[model samples]
Each structure stands twice: as structure tokens, then as C-alpha cells.
Target chain A: GQQVMQIPQYQHVQEGEDFTTYCNSSTTLSNIQWYKQRPGGHPVFLIQLVKSGEVKKQKRLTFQFGEAKKNSSLHITATQTTDVGTYFCAGIMIYNQGGKLIFGQGTELSVKP
Target chain B: EAGVAQSPRYKIIEKRQSVAFWCNPISGHATLYWYQQILGQGPKLLIQFQNNGVVDDSQLPKDRFSAERLKGVDSTLKIQPAKLEDSAVYLCASSFQTGMAAFFGQGTRLTVV
Candidate 1:
């Protein structure tokens, strides 16, 4: 069985503060994806990192994949009130048969104005 | 292109009742997944389908839960004699390929009393 663990299950910060959530997988992953779920809304795809030691950015957000492909992180800079939501990291493992996906317990982020 | 679609945005049923949720994935998508998400937690993988065939269902409760994707198009997940613990959001997602970003639909919120 594969497990993906995320840290800081809850986070609260004032506007313009920076926030980061870490994710670690018990097994190596073929790729890691990030998603966000707004309050009372569905999860939306954000970004995906494939190569080892890969780093990608989307505006104020930055995502990093570990060199071993066993961990990942998401950092949000200058958080805004509209950034309040749950951030989830999903790890995809490729097996000889197929690929299996697992999600980490999301980090709920709340930003106060 | 249309995203995943799920029916019955909300449901309320007493314990031991039966309920079913439907999902239609994006056109030409071959990978579909069903997940259970409890409050304050990330989505848990329940089952995965690859072109109307079961790929991974190890996490599904066979005794009370069942899902079917007929004609490699639409899918339906059914829960019979649901229990109080079944109160959660059932999400349907689809990806164009394995190990890729999954597009999720607005989940069906189930409240089992």
C-alpha cells in the first residue's frame, strides 16, 4: 500500500503572508499533481510535476518535486483572502499493470484580510 | 471541452437506505475514478475504471458498494443499505491518461442519518 502524508492540516495567515504545505509519499511516484478546493466547491486541478527535482510556478504559487520523486511541496506567496481553501497533493505511482493514484490529507488554508 | 459531470448534487437518506450517483466523464477520456471524501479530509480513492473495465477496486466496500461504467462512457456508483458513516462527498474524476491530472466533478454530498 502507498501512502501520501501532508503536513500542517490547518493553517491561518494574514493577507500578504506566505504559506507552504509539504507532502511525502511512502513510495516513489511517477508524477505529482496539485489541486485546490474552494469552500463548498469541487476540487480543481492546479499543476503537475513529473521530472525529479522539478520546480514549477504559477503566478504566486510555486511547486517542487523532490529529486527522489518521493516528496513534493507547494508554496503560496503573499496569500490573499481569495486564497482560502484546501490544498491537496495527489501522487501517482506506476505499476507494471497500471498507475494508481492516492491523495494526501489536504492542508486547509485560511487567509484573513 | 466539457468537464466531468455528476448528478444529484446533494442527497439525504436514513441508515439502511440505498442511493446511487451518476457520472459522465469528459469525452474520449479513458480513465475514470470514484472517491469518497469525508469532512475535513482529502478525497479517498474508492474505485477506478479504464474504459468500462475495473482497474482498481481494492478500496471499495464490496459488501455494500458497487459501481459500473457501461459502454465505456457513463458511470454509476451505488451504495446499498448505507450506514451513518456513509455521510461524505462522492467525487467522480476523469483523466485523459494514467498518471495525468484528473478533472473532478462537483461531488455528490451524501448525508446518511
Candidate 2:
């Protein structure tokens, strides 16, 4: 079975600080997607990476996919209160029978002003 | 465009009771998914539907849970004889295809006493 694991289950940072979360998979993945869930809100898609060793950036956020396609990372620079939420990484198994995603535990980000 | 839609934003029931949640995916989407998110945990895929047909349900507790997406559109998830451990948020998501990114609904929060 394929499994995705994330580190730093919870994180608290002051406004203007930086934060990062890492994700690893037990098996190689065809692609990876990132999502964010606000407090009391549903998960929202942020971005997706397919090419190996790819890196994408959106504003102050940076996402990177490992060369092996079995790991990924999300980094937030100068975090803000609006950045408070859980960040999840979902990996699509290369040979996924159902083409379903396997989600990591997620990193809960809490920012304080 | 409208995202996925789910009903009963919140629910509370005692053990042994039965509850059902409904979901309507975005129009033109061909893949739908049901996930369970316990407090402080990431959403876990319970079932996957590829246009009204079950693609995978390996993680679903079929002994007490069941789901259906008739006509390859609207879907429903039912849980019978619920237990306290069943308290969680049920999220519905849909994507254009198995390999595409997904959009999620606000989710139905269920609390079994």
C-alpha cells in the first residue's frame, strides 16, 4: 500500500517569520498536489507538480517536487495571519488502480501577530 | 463556476443511529471521491467513483458504510450503527478526471455520541 507522511504535525510562527513542511511517500508517485484548509473550511487546491525535481512558486509560497517524485516540500516566506491553516500534500501513486490520491497527515500552521 | 456541494454542514447523533450525506459534484466532472477527516487528521479516502461506477473502496468500512453515485452525478454516503469514533468531517470532492486536481466541498461534520 502507498502511504504519505508529513513532518511537524503542528507549527506556530509569528507574523513575518517563515515556515516549511515536508512530505514523503513510501512509493514513487506520478504527481503531487498541494491543498490548504482554513479553520472550519474545506480543503482548497493550491497547485500540482508532475515533472521530477520541479519547483513552482506562487507569491511568497514555494513548492518543490523531489527528483524521485517520492517527496515534496512547501515553504512560506514571511507568513501572515491569513496563512494560518493546515497544509496537505497528496501524492498520486504511479500505478494507482483507482487513480486516487494518498494524503499525508498535514502540517497545521498557526500564525500569531 | 460552482464547486462541489454537500449537505448537512453539521450533524450530531447517538451511537447505533444511521445518517446519510449527499454530494453533487461540479458539472462535467467525471471523478468523485468521499473522504473522512477526523479531528487533527488529514482526510482519508473512503471511496472513489468514476462516473457512477465504483473504482475503489478498499478503505471504506463496508460493513457499516456504503455509498452510491447514480447516473454518474449526485452521490450519497450512508453510515449505519454509528460509533463515537465515527465523529469526523465527511468531505466530497470531484475532478475532471482521475489525473486532474480536485475541488472539495465545505464538508459535512458528523458527531456520533
Candidate 3:
């Protein structure tokens, strides 16, 4: 079975500070996706990374996929209170004629204004 | 476009009771998934369906959990003889064919006492 592990189970940062979370997988993934879930809300798709050593940016956030396709990272520059939430990385794997997603434990971000 | 829809945003039940939750995926989406998310953790896939056929249920506890997607549109998840550890948020998501991103519903919060 594939498993994804995330570092920094919890993070507390002041407004305007920077934050980053790393995700690692036990096996190579076909693709990786990032999601954000606010308190009392459902997970929302943030972005997806497929190519090895790929990097994508959205406004103040940057996402990177490792060269080996077994790791990824999400970095937020100048965090704000609105950035407070849990971030998750999910790895997609195909086996036995089907696909499955393995999600990391998640990183809970707390931003104080 | 409408997102995935789930019924009974919250549920409270005694241990040993049975409870069910329903989900309606977005129109034309071919893939639907059910995930269980506990506090401080990422969502874990419970089941996946591709147009009314079961694709994967490897992580599901078949002894007490069951899910079905009839007509390839709406789906339901049932838990019988629930235990206190069954408390969590159940999320439903749908994605278009061939590697599209998933859209999630608000989720059903279940509390077993």
C-alpha cells in the first residue's frame, strides 16, 4: 500500500510570515495534488503537479514536485489570517486495474494577526 | 455548475446504531469517491465508483461499512453497529474522466457516542 507523510503536523505563524510544508510518498506517484480545508469545511482542490521537478505558483503560494516524483512541497509567502487551514498532499497510484489516492496526514496552519 | 451534494450535514447516534449518508455527484462526472476525515488528519478514501461500478473498496471496513452507487448518479454510505471511533466527517467528491480534478461536498459529520 502507498502512504504519504507530511512534515510539521502543526504550524503557528504571525501574519506576514512565511510557511512551508513538505510531503513524501513511500512509492512513486503518477501525480500529486494539493488541497486546502478550512475549519468546518470540505477539502478544496488547490493545484496539481505531474512532471518531475515541476513548480507552479498561485499568487503568493508556490508548489513544487520532486524530481523523483516521491516528494512535494507547498510554500506560502507572507501568510495571512485567511491562510489558516489544513493543507494536504495526495498521491495518485494505479494498481490492479484501478487508481487510488493516498493522502498525507496534513499540516495544520495557524496564522495570528 | 453545481458541486457535489451531501445530505444531513451532521448526525449524532448511539453506539451500536446504524446511520446512512447520501451523496449526489456533479453532473456528467464519471468518478465518485467517499472519504473519511478525522480531526487533525487527512481524508482517507473509503470507496470509489466509476459510473455505478465499484472501482475500489480496499480501505473500507466491509464488516460494518457499506456503500452503493445505483444508476451511476447518487450514492449512499451506511454504517451498522457503529462504534465511538466511527466519529468523523464523511466527504464525497466527483471528478471528470481522464485525470480531471475532484470537487468535494461539504461533508457529513457523524458523531457516535
Candidate 4:
């Protein structure tokens, strides 16, 4: 039973502070993706990492895929009220069908002004 | 571009009742996925369809849950004799292909009392 695990099930940060969430998979992954879900909204695709040790950035957000492809992380700098939501990391295992995406328990984030 | 679409934004039924949710994936997307997200948790994959074929459903609770993506287009998931634990948001997502980023729809939130 392969599984994706995320650390810090919850995070609270003051506006302008930075926050980070980590993800680890029980098995090697072919690729990893990051998604953001606003309160009461659907999960939206943020970014995807395919290459080993790949790193991508979007504005104040930074994403990294481990060299082994079994772990990933998402970091956001200078939190804002609009950033209040849950961050989820999903992975596709090397042996699984390409469409069988697995997700980790999200890390709920809250920002205080 | 239009995103994935789901119907009946919310539902509430007594335990043992049956319920079904529908979804239409983005135009031209070939992959569709169904996931269950309990409150405070991440979305868990229930099944995956590639075109009109079943690619993976290892995690789906077959005893009470079933889904179909007939015609390689819109899909539906049904749960019979639902239990209180079945209370969760049913999320439908689509992707252009395997190992690609997924676009999710506003999920159908189900409450089984």
C-alpha cells in the first residue's frame, strides 16, 4: 500500500511571514504535483515537478522535488490573507498507472493579519 | 477554458441511503479521476479512468461504491447503503493524460447522518 505523507497537518502564520510544507512518499514516484485549495473551493493545480531534483517557482511560492523523486516541498514567502487555504501534494508512483494519482493529507494553512 | 464540472454541490442523507454524483471533465482531457476527501484530510483516489477504459480502481470500496466513465466522457459515481463515514467531499478531476497536472471541479459535499 503506497502512501504519501505530509508534515505539519496545520500551519498558522502572520501576514508577511513565510511557511513551508513537506511531503514524502512510501515508494518512488514518477512525478509530483502541488495544488492549492481555497476555503470551500476546489483544488487548483499550482505546479508539477517531473525531473529529479527539479525546482520551480511561482511568484512567492517555491516547489522542489527530491533527487529520488520520493519527496517534495512547497514554500510560500510573505503569507497573505488570500493565501489562507490548504496545500496538497500528490504523486504518481513509478509502478502505478500514470493516471492513478495519490494524494497526501493536506496541510491546512491560516494567516493572521 | 472551462474546468471540470460536478453537480449537486451539497447533499445530506440518512445512513443506508444511496446517492450518486456526476461529473463532466474538461474538453479534450482524456483522464478522469474520482477522489474522496474527508474533512480536514486530503483527497484520496477512489478510481481512475482513461478514456472509456478503467485504468485503476484498487482503492475504491467495491462493496458499496461503483463508478463509470462510459463513452470516454462524462462520469458518475454511486454509493449504496452509505455509512456515516461516507460523509466527505467527492471530487472529480481531469487531466490531459497520465502524469499530467489535474484540474478539479468544485466537489460535491455529502453528509451521511
Best-matching candidate per DockQ: 1
**All candidates in order of lDDT, best leading:** 1, 2, 4, 3
Question: Sorted on DockQ, highest at the top, how do the candidates line up?
Answer: 1, 4, 2, 3
Candidate 1 residue pairs that clash? none
Query: lDDT of all predictions, in order shown?
Result: 0.94, 0.94, 0.92, 0.93
Q: List-wise, what DockQ does each model earn?
A: 0.86, 0.77, 0.68, 0.83
- List where candidate 4 sits over 4 angstroms from the true fold: none
Instruction: Give the range where candidate 3 chain A is weakest over 10 consecutive residues by summed lDDT.
Output: A93-102
Per-residue lDDT tens digits of candidate 4, residues B27-46? 99999999999888899999
Counting clashing residue pairs in each candidate, in order, gives 0, 0, 0, 0
Model 2 Cα lDDT, one tens digit per residue, A16-52 = 9999999999988889999999989888999999999
Return the TM-score for each candidate structure. 0.98, 0.97, 0.97, 0.97
Model 1 collision count: 0
- Screening candidate 3 with a backbone cut-off below 3 angstroms (N, C-alpha, C), the clashing residue pairs are none
Residue-wise C-alpha lDDT for candidate 4, range A1-113, written one tens digit per residue: 98999999999999999999999999889899999998888899999999999999999999999999999999999999999999999998754455478999999999999
Encode model 3's per-residue lDDT on B1-113: one tens digit a residue: 99899998999999999999999999999889999999878999999888899888999999999999999999999999899999999999998852468899999999999
As a whole number from 0 to 100, the lDDT of residue B73 in candidate 3 is: 91
- Runs of candidate 3 with Cα error greater than 4 angstroms are none
Model 2 docking grade? medium
